[model samples]
Target: MKRLFAFLFAALMLAPAVQAAEAPDVLIRRLSTEMIDRIRADEQLQSGNLARMSELVDSVLMPHVNFQRMTALAVGRNWRGASPEQQKQLMTEFRALLLRTYAGALASAKDQSVRMKPMRADPADKEVIVRSEVVQPRGGEPIQLDYRLEKAGDGWKVFDVNVLGVWLVQTYRSQFAQEVSANGIDGLIRSLVEKNRSAGAAGTR
Candidate 1:
């Protein structure tokens, strides 16, 4: 699951933001390519500077992603049980968790490049799947990647990702359920915060 999330998000995490008006496939292509190029050229990011990467994720990638939807999906049916305040907290912590994990992935991804497959979706459809491949430039086989997006107002927002046949939201749902079952939402939030803090410390070093 850790490796899956890393592969699933590495392309979108540290990229330069694209226009909201771009089609989903176009958006993925542009961002994926730009992220690879930019991350390689970026001294601080390539050196694993968490602060710089976090700033980019918060300012740039967050808007392009429907994180509220992501949090709801990850939390599953229990999402409706949370108070509005709890929901807000969950989103905050989840965002931090993803940013930290993504920063780590970006730092480690040195010889990888993203390639977009031909997109196949009707223009009238409100939901679409954008498919792509991640090339491991050093050798071996490419990875299968797909972004599941839904129309949100004028732009499409990514809510879940499928990598090598496993959906990221589904992968986390079981973990979240276990935590919620044992300790509840606040417990889950606390867990995320602590993990992110530890990851942050590692990133700084």
Candidate 2:
């Protein structure tokens, strides 16, 4: 699962939008390929420069994601318990956690490529799931990766991801629910903050 998430960091690094109306599968495939090439050629990123990798993900990958929805979904029923301020804080901390994880994982990216599977959705559908897999360079089993996206304005925004048979939002939902149950919404925010802090410290060393 760790390796699967690592591959996800590469696959989800969608580039800046060149076409607002681009098909979801095409968008994912093109940008993932571009990112793989960029990572392979960039010495700083390959050398584990978290700052650079994080910046790259923030600038290029985040724009395509509907992070507010992702955060809300991950929080599950507990999301309604959060005040406006708490919700904002939760989003901030969760986004930081994801950014740091992706940045750290991307440092080891090499010869990893995304293989896009067939997308099944009506053209008029507002939401859809795009399936895919990570083709490892070492010829290991291909890891399953899927994306749930919603049509926003003139483009698509990813809200959830499935990696190695586990959905990202669902996995986090379980953890967030446990935290909220034990210590309330504010407690969850604090926990996320501490987690991000610990990860940031480890990255610097």
Spell out the clash pairs found in candidate 2: none
Candidate number achieving the greatest TM-score relative to the actual structure: 2
lDDT by residue (120-185, candidate 1, tens digit) is: 999888889999887876686888889999987757889989888888889889999999999998
Backbone-clash count (model 1): 0
Q: Which stretches of candidate 1 lie over 4 Å from their true place?
A: 1-10, 13-17
**TM-score (C-alpha, index-matched) for candidate 2:** 0.93
Q: What's the CA error at residue 171 for candidate 2, in Å?
A: 0.2
Q: How many clashes (backbone atoms < 3 Å, residues ≥3 apart in a chain or on different chains) does model 2 have?
A: 0
Clash number for each model: 0, 0
Q: Indicate which candidate wins on lDDT.
A: 2
- TM-scores vs. true structure, each candidate: 0.89, 0.93
Model 1 worst lDDT run, 10 consecutive residues: 1-10
RMSD of each: 2.1, 1.6
